[model samples]
Structure formats: C-alpha cells, structure tokens
Target: MPWKESTTMEQKIEFICEWRTGNHTITELCRSFEISRPTAYKIIARFEEEGYEGLRELSRKPRGTHPNATDEMVVGGILLLKEKHKLWGAKKIHKLLYNDFSEEKIPTVLTVHNILKKHGLVSPQKRLRRVKPIHPIFDPKLCNEVWSADYKGKFLMGNKIYCHPLTIADSKSRFVFTAKGHYKENLASAKAEFTKVFRKYGIPQQIHTDNGSPFGSVAAIQRFTRLSYWFIELGIMPVYSDPSHPEQNGRHERMHRDLKAACAKPSAHDLKAQQRRLNSFVKEYNHVRPHEALEMQTPASVHEFSTRPFPEKIVRFDYDSELKVLKVTRNGSVRWGSYNWVYVSASLQGKHIGALEMGNGIWRIFYRNVFLGFLATIYHLGQAKLRSNLI
Candidate 1:
C-alpha cells in the first residue's frame, strides 16, 4: 500500500515553486510554504537531484561509501583509541580518528563513546566523594537538576579592598544561579543573599556546599550551621565535603577557578567597579560561553527558574500525630514515643519536638521549630554494654 499522509510532499513542493515564481522572497516563500530556510533549501536540492520525484523524499542515509567499512572495523578502531589514550574523552577520540583516518569512515564522538562503553573500556565518572547519594545528583539527564554553590574566596580589588563572591549554579543544566559579591564571608551575609536566590529559583532538592562554616560545619559532613539550618528548615538538604577535600566539591571549585580567571584577576579600583565587570562576565558565561559538558550549548538554553514558590514560613512537621507519645523538657532532651532523644542545647526544654521519620534506621530530632539532629538505631547496644561491663 502507498504511504498515507495528510499533505503530500509533491504538493508542498509545487506550492513552494508557485510562490517563488510569483516573485516571493526566500523568507516570504518559506513563510508561505510553512517551512524553514534550511527546509526550503532542502526542497530545492531535491528538485535538482532527481527532478520532482526526488523532491518527494529520498533516503536520508549517505550513499557511495566503501562496502569494506564494516561495523566491526569501526568498533575496533574506537577500542584501540580508548586503550592507547585512556585519558582522552570522546571529542579527543573523534579528533584522533579524523586526523588518523579518512573523514568518510570516521564516526561521531558520541558513537565512539558508545562503542567504548559497550566494550567496557571506560567507567562513568565517579560522583563527588564527600556528598551523600541523596544530595540531588546532577547527571544532566535533561538539564537543570542541580546547581553548585560556593564562595570564590576573598581577593583584593585594585584599590586594595577585598571582595568575596557567592556563587550558585544548576548542576545538571550548568545554569549559573548567581555570581555576585558579598561584603564578607560570614554566615549572616551569605544567608541574606542566598535567601533571595532561594526565593527566586525556588528550593532545590539539595544544595552541594563546601565545608565552610557558613554553609556547613567541621563536626559533621551533613550538619547544618545557622545558614544551612535555614536550608533544612526550608526542605532543602545541605551537602558538605570532607575536610580539606576541595576536589570532592569539584564543580563549584572549578567554577571558582574560571570566575577568578575571567573576572577577579582583572581588578578595577573598587568593589563596585569590579562587580560591574564581573556581571558582564557572568552574562557571557550563562548566555554565550560554550560548555563542553553541555555539548557546547549555552547554559541558558537548558535552564529555567523553578515554578515552586519559596514559603515565607518554614514548613513544620508534626510528630504528635505520627508518634504515639510526645515529650519536651527544659534541658533540650526528649523522652517520648518510646525513645530517649538528646539535643545540642539545654535552652530548648519545655518546647514541642517534631520528629521527621527517615527510613533505614534513621530519624531527625527536632526541638520546637529548630532541627536538633538525626538519630540512627543502635542494634548491638545490649551486646556492647555486656562486653563493656565484663571488661
């Protein structure tokens, strides 16, 4: 049976020719034919290739390649490159193939990577070391799932005044959230500024942060300081890197390097002027700078602010209904729901405790409106106690 269609390709071609013969401009012809410039050019090419018949629809596959170029040969070449240059990425592999072999036989970089992966020649890149698995992994499956956050550290302007940049990014989309200066690197300042971002962008499921006091603490990898505590209160999990492990949070670290190279190094007389210049660079970074991870697309093309609104009041979870019992004491310790809970401060006694259930033997202990910390079941406690007493 002939292929059934709503509109015939021949008819579309005839329309294009008629419009052109009537002295319609290329743009006007394209508009009248409901086609793009490239599509119009394709139709014209078809008309020349095999006359009107060719204009109907030819096979998209390229023709006249050597029959000897088998799939196995292409796979073998890709595997050889992977073995020889274990460090080279897909683009570099493609370049090597183009430089070494004829262009007609060479495949795309994506195809090369696919072949390498199929042969188990390489492993996927490891995730950030210090981050928890739940901290919004940003594989860029489509775009804009995660955004990196950090301060660029402090540097002097031409006038010798210091400027500290607080940066945020979309991890999956590679969209730059913000790249503006803060008066200082303190928690209050960082919180005040980042609040604006949370308000504008809505809350990300998780925000990856370095082991800085403002974003995190030295005691625990996922512990929240005052600013990060605010994030937790807002339903955003705070992720932290191990101490002295800057590379664990490599994305933000890398961005800082690029930001410094692009904006901070070329210092102006004051922070205001330097910031003005930095703003321009940020605009370029988001709208023009080609990202290799994004397949050379600008970050803006793959990013948009989330529609979820940032609630002015922090969301409160009620444990009274979930737990069989509820308790509060002036000493910030709670004995309720058949469990004993200890909190950091003694001042929170007599206030209500909210318990958020985290699965797999974990529970978050909260006092009044503040989240005290998490708790995990100690299954071998009786055995350890017996051993200790025996000792």
Candidate 2:
C-alpha cells in the first residue's frame, strides 16, 4: 500500500513500533509501507542515531557545497567581468576568462552562466522560437564576394536631431567596413559614404541590401535605384531580400541589433559625437569581438581586402552588333517605332540601353550585360507594354 501524505509520519511511527515489537521482518515492514528495504533501513538508522528527533522529517536540502561547484575565486572573476561588460553573456565571458584564468581552472560556459544566475546578475530569457530557413540565404565563401549595407533605424540623439546610422559589413567575415551617422537617408550621403568605403576596401562582387530607397525601388525595373545603377556601372551586381522579410538578410540585421544596443540606447549629444561612437563600435566589432560563427575568431583576422580596385572613371558600356542601341532621354524614355516613347526609369536618364528583338513582336532590353526586362514592341495606340517579370 502506498503511504498517504497525511499519515506518512504515523506510518513511520507504526513501522518502528511494529519492528520494536519484533512482530514483522524487514521485508514485511517494507511491504506494509510500500517502500524499498533500503528506505526502511535508512529510517531505522536515522532513528537509532538520533531517536525521536531523527524520526521528525529532516531537511531535504543539501548541507554542504557540491564537489563540482565553481570555486569562489573563479566566481569572483566572472562577476567582475560581468560588471565590466553588463551586456555580454556567458559565452563571451568564458572566452575572455582565458586571459586571466588557465583552461584547467576556468569553468564551463554553463557553470559561468549559473554563477551569474545565482547572484541575480542575469535573468533567464525566453527561448527564441526558431523558424525554418524558408527563404534562400546567400552565404559568400570569400570576403569581398558580397557586402551587406543598411540604415540602422533612426533614433533621436541628446541634441534633438534624428540620427540615421548607415552600416556596411562584409558578408563572409562579418568585418564591418564603415558605420557612418547621417542626418538623413539620402542619395548624396549614402553615395559619399559608399565612395569612401569603396576606395578603401575596394569593390565587392555584389552588394546585398533590403528593398529601401537609394538602394532599390519597387516601381523601377529590376528594383534598380540610382545607387544600384552606379554599382552596375562598376561591374558590381546588387541583390536584395524580399519585401517585409528581414530574416532573409539575418546576418546584417543581427549586426544592426548589436549596433543599436551598443550605441543607440544611450544616444550621443550630436552627429559628431554619434559618429565617434559608431567608429568605436566598428573597431570593437571587427577587432575585439569574437564571433561564434567564425569559431570565436575576430572579423579583422579573417577578412581580406577586395582585389577589384575602385576606378577613377566609369567606363562606358558597349553593346553587341546584333542589338539596336539607343540612349535614354532626359524624361527616361526611348524612341520606339519613331513616334511611341517607351518610359523607362527616370534614374536611367542619359544612360544607353540595348534592345534585342525576340520572336513574336517581343523585344528584350539590356543595360550593359544585365537584362533589364522584356518589352512588347507592337505599337498599339501609341503605347508599348513593358513586361518586367523576367527578373
């Protein structure tokens, strides 16, 4: 019979009394109590050692320190580091511990976490709900294969000016190229910052960004903005994540999160001060911070400068002999069928485009080597339908 919770003490007393009477064997007592022989022996041993005091329920809590518990000195070191970098967690703290503590002396990451947790220094965070990688994410093997850039969401500074931080990082090594604070997200500011980065880091094969202004346009052909067109002119391709899906460019987004935490939470007084803070963040991120993806290696140690140098002057694009070439007018339209003007993007004004006639009144367009889209050349009521779905 299982012992009732209310009658547990009574049952223990009855078992002891029955044993004292010598009426029941150890097995019989265990059977009556629905407990093992070892439990009966333990109860009897405690009774023998301390009489009725032992029969009263003893504390279930552990009496002394565990054998595998972290040493007091090591706990002090962990707490000190946590005090220094309150934002950092156990993994980063564990890595830093090697500077002062030997590998044998240092505790595991979990142990360090428990040390922080025990002292109420760190709170348990809800586990992130993981989702499947539904969208295709491009992972570059080389440093300059792709670079990701974005404007970290605008935040107000102490001086009451809204600061827009533009951050660019190498896709493979996560090496931050630049993090510039701008007054606004405009073409001139973005172009100036990018020119500086391009001249220093050289040109990447491709640049990845979200569907945002100065980088891409929803209405334009192939989502090419003036900035992206410039990339095309430099023989660099521009790529983008799908609209409303930030996780497609998750690595860059993750960096933005860190940037906001480090610099934006306690915003600087002015743009100049904000720029200084960004510079510090870039230095620490590239050189000091150890990335888990890179096996805890710093980004600066892994990244290499691009081989393609930024040209002083952009070379003009030449088309093949078979295609008909025409320059886009100031109004961003081409002369079609001598009278009908097919409207392209105004951003493509003064640029030359080539049109190759495909079968069935369809004409395929191209800017340099990149295919713009398909255009139906049959002039119906002075209107030419442009089909940009091929992209």
Candidate 3:
C-alpha cells in the first residue's frame, strides 16, 4: 500500500521486497502497489528471470530503424542541397525535395532536421516556452474591412543610414499591400506611402497598429497622433495594440519576420535595390505564397479593392442640432462662454467640436464623433484643475 514516486528503482525494490514475503495474493499486491496485475506479474517475472537490472525501465523508442529513412545516398543529396542553399531551412528543403521525389521516398521536415543534426550542421534546439496569445480583436467578415499597419524595425542598407520599412496588409485576406523602404521614419514619408496605398487599394473601415509614433503617441490623450488624426479624417478608425505586446498584431509581425528573412537579412545595396526586393516579395507573398490561415489559398485570390474609394478632397465634419457646437481657435482653445476657455488638441486647431453632456454640467468634448476629453462647463471654482486634463 506504500506506493511511492521516489524512483523507478525504489518502487521496484518495494514491490519485490513485499512479494518475497509471499503473504499477499497477486491482485492484492497489484492493488497495494497501485499497478495492474499484468504489470505486477511482468515486473516479478523480469526480476526472477534477469535479476535487479530487469526492473529498470526500457526505452519505448522503436528498436528497428524507420522504413523510409534516408540512407547514405539520400543524406548526400540533402547535404548537396544544403551546400547549394546554405540558408534554406528544413521546411524549405523538404518542400523543395517533395516535388522531385515521391511523397513516401522524400524525408519530412523532422527527418531533415535529424539528418542535419547528425551531420553537425545544426544543434539541438531548446523547447520554447508557451506564451498566451495576444491576437488582435478585430475580425473582418470580408476582405478590406480592416487593415493592419506597422513599421518593421529599421535595417541598414548599403546606403549611409538606416531604412525603415512601412508595411500594410489586409486583415481578412493577409494581403500585404505594400512594404516600402522609407528614407525617414517621420510623418511626411509615411503619409506619402499611405497615400499611394489608399489611392491604389481604396480605404478600409479600420487600420490597426501598435501604440507607437506615426500611428500613436504615448503622451497624447488616447495616444492619438496627428497621423492617426489624418486616418480619422479620412473616415478610418485607428486601433492600437496594448503596450509592449507585439503579438496583438501577430499576423503583421509574422509578415515582418518573412520580410526580414527574405529582404533584410543581407540588406540590399541601396534604397532602390531594397524597393525592388520588397516589390518582388510582395508579388510572391500576395500572388504565390499560400497562407495556412487562409485555408492554403493565396491572399491575392481572396482580396479585392475596397468599394469605399479614397476621396480626392477632404470632407468637412458636420454637427447636428442635437449637440452644442464650438469652433476651435488658432490657439486650439474653444471660447466656451464669454469668459470660459477650454483647450483642445493643437492638431484640431481651426476645427469644430461637439459638446456632449455627461450629467452634473460636466461636458465631454468631441472632434467630430471621437470623445476627446471632459470639461465641467458650469465653472465650479474648485474644478479649475480639471481643465488641465482636457487635450
């Protein structure tokens, strides 16, 4: 009855020592040791036949070698391909060889890994820790409803400075619209690329990005940057990932990985060469690469230009009679009453904002429909500090 997890040897010793007493029945001994009758018998017989060594556990690994395993000639073939394309991984190698050899004849990605390890071409990898998924919440039922945008980290070209890549993709289809190298990571360069993508593919309902510059700001209220304000002006809602959580925009991050491997590993000679590489990658990724999440279909097959075409000119915001409208001055302050002045964002200078009441004479402000911030409009002398909270 003293079943223990001390060691395999300890359990076996206990079982044998108890069995030697010859007082208990087989079923009783099996139950006492927390083992089946068959298992108990097998252990007893092994100890009797082969002594203490027999009680030790045997490997469950297959005794015979794999039937379709690569022999010396096939190993030579793998090495030859590896020598030819040194950077190609096992999966890529397996995909390459799968066509030439019969499915049963060619080795799998795992087998390829083993061969590489046997040859000292690769080291054994440590088990990766499992992390919780931070998948972005927006699920577009159809293509072009939600789009993702991010700047893939900068890399140096043959040019003197670094080049930042601005990548954009359709959320539903995973179609990468563009992955252009930028001379600067500032707004002007980003807007130029975005304008081209907008003009080409049309506008989406929302654009998801991380809480970073160009797309967002840390100091700004709601982290809405001027670039995001522009997106809002164009009838696009901007969504942001939680801070330090890259996996929230995981699909885009995965694309960035492929982009790094394909184009930026050994970066191109100049901006122009990098642009050419990106163009090639985009063509292959959209029209050729089969995405597993997309049921192994190409993104190009699923994506089409959005029906909500980009407007040539900016559309002015309209306020209904239900809300009190206040015009923002050059200094980004609204002259709320004869004496009261509420400050809005400098980005909203010369714009109109609607004031929505939130009870107790506390007014929440809006640039168009976005909730900017709050104001106690009745001018409680004690609440002068509340004005600083408005942006």
Candidate 4:
C-alpha cells in the first residue's frame, strides 16, 4: 500500500486525517501508508506537537555536534606549527603533530588542511600533471637494487656563491644515500661524495641517472662518461633516463623538490653551514619523514644496506676462451696490426676488450659484456685497410 509518488504529501495528510477520525487503528494506518508502526506514531506525535507544520518533514540534522570535534587549542597549535615550519604542508604538519603529541588527540590530514584554509594559511593548489612514461616500468625489487643520482641545479647561497647539490637515493626503499651540497658539479666533486656513500652503503646492482655531466656525457656514444665507465668497472650497470624527460627519474626529482623546499629555500652562508643543513635534512628524510608511497613508513624502516661491499681495488672480468682479446692502448686505440691503430674510448684504455666474430671479417667488440662496436678489417696492398671497415 505504498503511497503514490505524485501525491505523497496529500496522501500522508489523508492518512493522518483518517487516524484522527478513529475509524482505523494505528497499525492499520501504518500498513495503508506502507510505513512502520513507529513511523506512524512519530507522525501522529509530530501532528499533536506542531499541528500541520509538524506533520511536514522536520530537519534531520542534530541540534548539537559531537564533542570530539577539533578544539580551538588544536586550531591554534596548527597555526603555530604552520608559522614555525613555513615550508611544511598539511600532511607534514599532521605528521609532526602525531610525533610531538603522541599522547594527545590528533587531527586528520584533511581536518588540518581545512583549519589551514580557514586561517587563510593554505592557498588553493593547482594540480601538477605528470607526463606518463611509455617505456617499460623498471622497478627495483629490493633495497640497493637500483640507486638514482642527480645534480639539483645550482642555486645562489646567502653569500651569493652558487652551490651545486649532488643527490642520490635508493629507488626501492626511498632511502636517501647522499645529499651532498657540492661547490661544483665536476667529476672530482661527484666522485668524492660517491666514494663516501659507497663506503657506507655498499654497492648497488644499477645506478640510474639523468644524462648530465659528471654522470654522463652528451657527446659520448651510449651517453657514457668517465664516471659511468667507473661505475661499470665496479660491476654496477649505469643507466640514463630518456632525454628531456625528468619524470623518467621522477622519484629522485621529487626528493629534490623536498630538499629544495627544506634546505635550499634559505641557502646557507657557506659550504660548512650548508652541509650542516643537509645533514639535518638527511636525518629527518631518512629517519623521521614518512613517505606516502611506502605506506607511510620512513625510509630507514625498510631500507637495508647492500650485501655487496665495495672492493678495495678495481675488479676485472675474464672473457670466455673462444672470444679473442684486444688491449686498448694508452692512445685510446687498439693495435689492429703492426701500424694500424683504431680508436675506442679513452676510458677503455689499458682495458681488454673481447671480440666476438659476427660473420665474414666483421667482429663485434665488447668491454666486459657492454657492446663497443663492430669491426671489419679489409686487406689492401698486402696490408689491412682500416678505411670504412668499421661496421
């Protein structure tokens, strides 16, 4: 006996009117209205209390809100924290609140954001669109399986001196291995900091980097540089992101953002002072700051040191017996015969390259599994003609 959708109000009025006449019991009226007995009693009670006005629907909202709502003191505390750590956003503030007031009630992230919005502290954030990578996803399964390196663009410190930051992090665990603020982005500066990190964290299976100086050379084939060669020599595969695409190295870039916000915003007066700030940031980044991607766990909680320790000296690889070996001379070339010297990379000098015969006279050369190029020796005038023999 559901009421017609077209005349619901009129039908309720007629039903109540019928009850008022005492022709039918409340239970029978409820069945006619397709409502429960409690609903019928409530309607009658409302009609008795407020006449026709009460018979109409009343507001369902509670007159009083729950007492567990955020307190004025909490609002004040959030503002105070926002003022103290001007660079921190709502999530960071919330995390700090939990850390500082573990025994007290803490507000949710959205609640904290609302409080900030009410106080005109937080501005409307524009969504940052990321360019999706079309390449196959490369995920490091364990800690130290892959490490990312980058040089955050140099910024002027308080002393008006430019400081080039060298940053490296564990890809899987989001653990920061090094965040050294170097004076320069040259090979010397990069090597020193990397050596320190290697001594501490051991070696990773692969080192991923942007195609930049010290890490790589744009002119070098395969984007290989001296530093890249050194990494390969250490048995670590050095990889690069696609050119002009920062999102390819997105994780390291995101860390750079935080680092910039936390430390570089107010650049230190000198290297020593800046290093101290970097030290503090590293401590918090690794041990205190929670990453949303890691299920809100700090990097230190999940990151384990790599088992492969850095060797005391450079390690060499022995080739198979069938593969022929060629020694790259100091001039960055191999003695193909008595007088013919063809160029390889200077970085490969004094190193043995394994030659695998492809077909005909053409042979493929490799410096420890890394492909160098193909070589074809053509004999002319009773001697091998170098010519365009390189394939």
Model 3 lDDT, residue 176, Cα: 96
User: Best lDDT goes to which candidate?
Assistant: 2
lDDT of 2 by residue, 1-391 (tens): 4565866778788888998999889998887778888888888998899885687876898879888777788888999999987777888888888888888889999989988998899967899888775754688988899899999899999999999999899999999999999999999999999999999989999999998988888778999998988999988999998888878888999999999999999999999999999999999889877789998888999999999999869997779999999889999998887668898889889999999999898889998998889988766787887788563
What are the per-model C-alpha RMSD values against the true structure?
Answer: 21.6, 4.1, 7.0, 8.2
Best by TM-score: 2
Candidate 4 lDDT over residue span 242-272, tens digit each? 7887777788889999899888888899988
Give the alpha-carbon lDDT of every model. Answer: 0.66, 0.89, 0.81, 0.82
Q: Would you list the rank order by TM-score, best first?
A: 2, 4, 3, 1
Which runs in model 1 stand beyond 4 Å of their true positions? 1-144, 320-352, 355-391
| Deviation in Å, model 4, residue 92 alpha carbon | 3.3
Model 1: ten consecutive residues of lowest lDDT: 382-391
TM-score of each: 0.53, 0.86, 0.71, 0.76
38 in model 2: Cα distance from truth in Å?
Answer: 9.1
Sorted on lDDT, best first, the list reads 2, 4, 3, 1
Model 2, 336: alpha-carbon shift in Å? 0.8
Q: Whose lDDT is higher: candidate 2's or candidate 4's?
A: 2
Q: Between candidates 3 and 4, which one is better according to lDDT?
A: 4
